[model samples]
Target: MTEPTDLTPSGRLPVTIEEEMRSSYLAYAMSVIVSRALPDVRDGLKPVHRRILYAMRESGFTADKPYRKSARAVGDVMGKYHPHGDSSIYDAMVRMAQHWSMRVKLIDGQGNFGSVDGDSPAAMRYTEARLAKASSFLLDDIERDTVDFQPNYDESENEPKVLPAVFPNLLVNGAAGIAVGMATNIPTHNPGEVIDATLAMIANPAIELDELMQIIPGPDFPTGGIIMGRSGIRRAYETGRGSIPVRARAEIEEIRKDRQAIIITEIPYQVNKATLQEKIADLVRSKEIEGISDIRDESDRSGMRVVIELKRDATPDVVLNQLYRFTQLQTSFSANMLALDDGKPRTMGLKDILEAFLRFREEVILRRARFDLNKARDRGHLLVGLVLAVANIDEVIALIRAAPDAATARESLMAREWDASEVVPLLELIHDEGNVIIDGKVRLTEAQARGILELRLQRLTGLEREKIQGELGEVAQKIGELLAIIESRPRRMEVMREELLAARAEVATPRVTEISDALGDQTDESLIEPGQMVVTITRDGFIKRTPLEVFRSQNRG
Candidate 1:
């Protein structure tokens, strides 16, 4: 071998290529596993989001079972899927099932998990559960090949990095995660709309994102309230960042024939129910509002019923306005639509989500379109072969088997000039065979061969084809919808993505020192009077090297 050449200059120490290569490769691998693959505490999931489903499944929470302890469900998930602590697992499961926590809760519980007090859930042994109809619906195809699976933390178990997650949980249920230098926070969404969007994405490979948004509108909270405006929703969807103002619902309640109380039945989620109750109590205590009667928790298993009894001579509307103004009873639901995209933290507005979903929708379309096109091409090729085989049936069988190769048989038939049309059907028959090929016995007519090609390549009229077409239409629609989002400026995710990339860029920059060269400008001004030092500070600027010479005496002209 020739002598090894030195990469470094003569004065510099020799650097081995292997050491540098090892360090760089090691860094990339660690970054992918820790920042992209792992789940955060907010979701309380690991590689698998199984606890949410497993807890519901184990708690006897079947669509048929009576509602039971959410706590027990949590316990099972912790013991089996989690193998971590009990509290957080139980809490995550509860949140996934809670109407208050989710825009559309996937689980339906019959018993108490915990109140809005943010109290910890009970131990798993004390709780019980079963699968909800919704959970079962989502998990319907788990056994089928609709999704892929990989090994769990240990080789002993297997986990799904993602379930079929067919509804696009990233947009519907939303998500939040934090890694070393990244974090994601996505908002909740409506199930009906999300399902519609998912179906749309599956159909058309080129649906516009804007069209998709028309179906989704914006997030529909489970509390059954309203988002104050459309503009913010649009902004959030486009830019992946925006907030919506939300208000609590209140109505007049009659205690007696003449006495009335302004009762608050529902409060905005993230609004403190107990605190609102206390605030009202405090109002009663402070005599800020002259309410004549009692304050009691009439809330029960059915729902929240806050009874605010009033004096026979009270003004309900005025007090309602004040409550709305002062409390979270009516507050802003800040929709900081943020989430993880390709292993980085990103903030999205509604438009951003719409745009991202649109892009994803188109990708699925392209994949399906390619699949369909290739399928059509195969039938076209077979149609040609069958035509040739049928024309000269006798010689074809011998040629097919003894020739030992498809290409050789094809060559032999082409040279013979006997009926090329007949050979086409032979090719087709071989392709459709359940058992054997080139048997020579299978026969066909020119009309029959033409008919098969027409039927196979023409797109099927069968139920499966119709279903696939419908899905294609939906995906196409979504692609169209997302494209429309571009008009709405949907692409907040791009902004967030840019920010994360900028952060990464900063990481690559040298961080040795930040010494200001302006320090040399310092001049002794100790004799200057206190509060009269006459300092000329560089206000509202950076790289502020305030040279001592730059400062002028307060009295200096």
Candidate 2:
């Protein structure tokens, strides 16, 4: 009683601190990797995102449904599946609804989610949300058992481990996250382009990366901008990591007499426009960048237009170059295409990601077909029982009339043998082995016996009996089709392709960011045209430029 244990329970073995710490740290790292940071390669969503979508779908917050209070969704997700803070869950949900964040937004938000100026979204109480139309692609087959499910953190509820994403969501929307010792920063691509590339891969698995690149040239940011050079795009797509430079789209325009301005229409992806403007102003005040007379934001609902007004004598091209060089007007999107593949984090290239998605989709298709086939067989089995009872109407009715209770009637039905000729072809069609023919007679199973005892009086009519045969024929045909789909690899691939094409048609949009062959860094001298100018100055200290052709040779004069 006086002896003290070393912080270990009595009768428990002692463990080294180092070993315990190492094991604990490893567990933490894996939790972060699987539960928080990385998106599943199948659905392109992290655990939190998957939970939110599943919860919303469960609550009937579908694309066609009316919007519900965002707080309700956040509460349900946190209480049921995600066990995280309400703020973090709401933030993730808000990002999904942001048009500028996700290439194909998954949520239809009814309030100010956020702005490209790095504004924080309003509180969950103020916002309303529902699933977007495109989100159906990921959750369509979830109820059909196309994907597996696991218990929630508390084991009180079930949630999908991964979505049965029919679309190539990983590439279409992309993802970014930071885990314990690793991170991921996948860039979004065009939906149409991604679908075309996937179809190409299906058609020819041996197609080279170069060919795939032809279909999907590079990342397409939701905010339109220019992606300079293909070198970085190639590196990222080939090696799963690279730095791609993006520049704002601007044009030099003469605003008024002798005044020029640079009108910026688009900014780089993830860049805060307000912060970018502040940085530019900081540089201007510090004299780091010169020649700016004024700066103003003239952006509106039509489009983005940040006007950088230049002094009368200021060179617009030079000032624009300085802005690009020093401010967020130009930025680099460093892509680290890391994600979870089969619960292990891996850096996947373009082809690797596509191949993994195709494999997963094939499995989903097969599982769904099997689930349908089983359902059809069960229905066909019941219909066979009814057809048998209908064939032997007199004997069945007489046995039921004599029994003292329903249980006895069921036993009597199972005890008696019936003609197997009528249901033999139907059984063969459904491939049902539950019913066996012995000496040209079949004994009813407990399920079939129950079915006969529960039959309604009206179902004994001639019309109802014919209806059973017709319905069984339909079920048998469906069973045959499902079996064919499961057995044929080519047909499964075709199904996947058609589903992907349909999703593409719904979500595909014109590429916003332009990819140019020019390099990121450009000098003002390169933009200047080769021409001669005559400089003139008046005695009053006014200066002007006159074209060389303005003055003719005046030797005689």
Candidate 3:
């Protein structure tokens, strides 16, 4: 054949390149936005992060348990849930364990996990990890059908769609990511403050932003530093985007006679100490900044201390100001509160995130109550069957003896009806539907008959019989409590509040970052000495500054 006929469906219809490219690019962008880059508002986790936590929990690597090699957990996540590269999975897991990386670490690591100086972490095979106790709040009630589950990539296993987070994890531990055309850079907040804000919202659904801010002041970076002003924080909370200026904590100290030095204890969030030192050194070498006699890092286990000794005549304040102006001693954090909400990327304010978490937590509480109710009802049904068998012990024994086998005896038990007068009240209390009552008699269900057959001879003793009745009464009470939680909204809310308080007790800590009202503007004028200078402009328009003495007065210059 000269040419093969087109076998494609739609008769190989012709399409413009522009149309195809537009559709394909849009598909790819959505995939990245939903599947990878942004965190889910409910759990504050991307796919890789969620997978790592879930996998580690499944492997029994909890905080109380012994730590296992990180590579093992990474392998489990990649093979079962995430289906990604091992390096990416390990990197995500390591970040969760790093104290400086997460506001509240989700994982407790035993080995070295990098440093604030931007050093790389040790290999995953050498490091060990386990789930932190705080994670229990996120993972509790997961097995009770509180959240939905979807099949993994290869359809070989199932994983949760989102964790049944008790607290508002989205704001408590924040998140950062970059997608196709968007990115999120939400700063973390103190756990105690976040929980308080959530509780306040619950108490007053119509609470305004002003009232909420009173509870949660501003972002609390793990690397504690002073926030210069409140205006940026207000803008971010109101509109989900703003920049806050942060300055390192430094003090002028006299280390010798007639000489002073600058002592830096803390740096801006996400700023590397080593790089900052290098930048300062380069500026001094190029003579851009003057008066520094020596620079040394005296940081140790106690805390961070970068010492900048000054010349005898150098003004400590002036040199420190120059460092702030030319180095990373001062920086601004640009907050972009972007995350995935209901499978779409959204820019959410503080109120939007808290509201979403509340809605999700309510659903979790309802689902868990239903699950417990069903379980209690089932146990009560079995106990009722056991009681009947004990009441008619003589007849039951005779019938079993006459039967040829266990199967025939079970069928005979199912076929016969017994007096319902003794158990009718218990059945009503527990809401059990395993048996049917007609007039004054009821027949045993298949499940009940099998349970009776499996009963031991010792259960017929007087004390044992009394024990069974007592256990049945406890189960009945439990069933009624679960029913109330399911039927009434207020009862469920009370239960949720109690659980939240319990979680708060475990993870709450005092605020680390300090918020101040001092204004910080970008300028070098204040760092200059209080003296006159000569400004010269060339014919070509370049300008330069020189000391007044450099152009000494002459006869007629």
Quick one: best lDDT, which candidate? 2
Query: What stretches of model 2 exceed 4 Å from their correct place?
Result: 1-12, 523-557
Per-residue C-alpha lDDT of model 2 across residues 1-557, encoded as one tens digit per residue: 59766665576778999999999999999999989999999899999999999999999999999999999999999999998799999999999998889999999999889888889999999999999999999999898899989999999999999999987899999999999999999999988899999999999999999999999999999987999999999999999999999999999999998999999999998999999899989999998887888889998888899999988877777788888888888899999999999999999999999999999999999999999998998888999999999988999999999999999999999999988998888789879988999988998899899888888999988899889999999998999889889999999999888888898889889999899999897676644444687788999999987667764343226
* Per-candidate alpha-carbon RMSD to the true structure: 18.0, 5.5, 3.5
Best-fitting candidate, scored by TM-score: 3
Candidate models: Cα lDDT each: 0.51, 0.91, 0.89
**What is the Cα-based TM-score of model 1?**
0.54
Tens digit of per-residue lDDT, candidate 1, span 1-557: 89766655665667679988888877975564443434322221334355567445544567687766666666556555566666666666666666566654566654565676455455555655556554554453444433345654455555443343323456555665554444454556665565555445445435665877776776655454445556656666777666555555567977789989776666665666777788877876787656437778777878777777777766676566556655566655555555544434456554444445545433333333344444444443444343434334456666656766655555554444443343434334323332122443333334333333234322333564455344434444444444443333224233223323332332222211111212111123421212322334356653433334445542358
Whole-structure CA lDDT of model 1: 0.51
> Against the hidden reference, what TM-scores do the models get?
0.54, 0.92, 0.93
Candidate 1, residue 35: how far the Cα is off, in Å: 6.9
lDDT of 3 at 18: 100
Better of 1 and 2 by lDDT: 2
Task: Look at candidate 3 and tell me the lDDT of residue 38.
Answer: 93
Residue ranges of candidate 3 with Cα displaced over 4 Å: 1-15, 531-557
lDDT per residue as tens, model 3, 367-465:
998998888888888889999999998888888899999999998998889999878987997889777899989988887888899999899999999
Compute the lDDT of residue 410 as modeled in candidate 3: 95
The whole-model C-alpha lDDT of candidate 2 against the native structure comes to 0.91
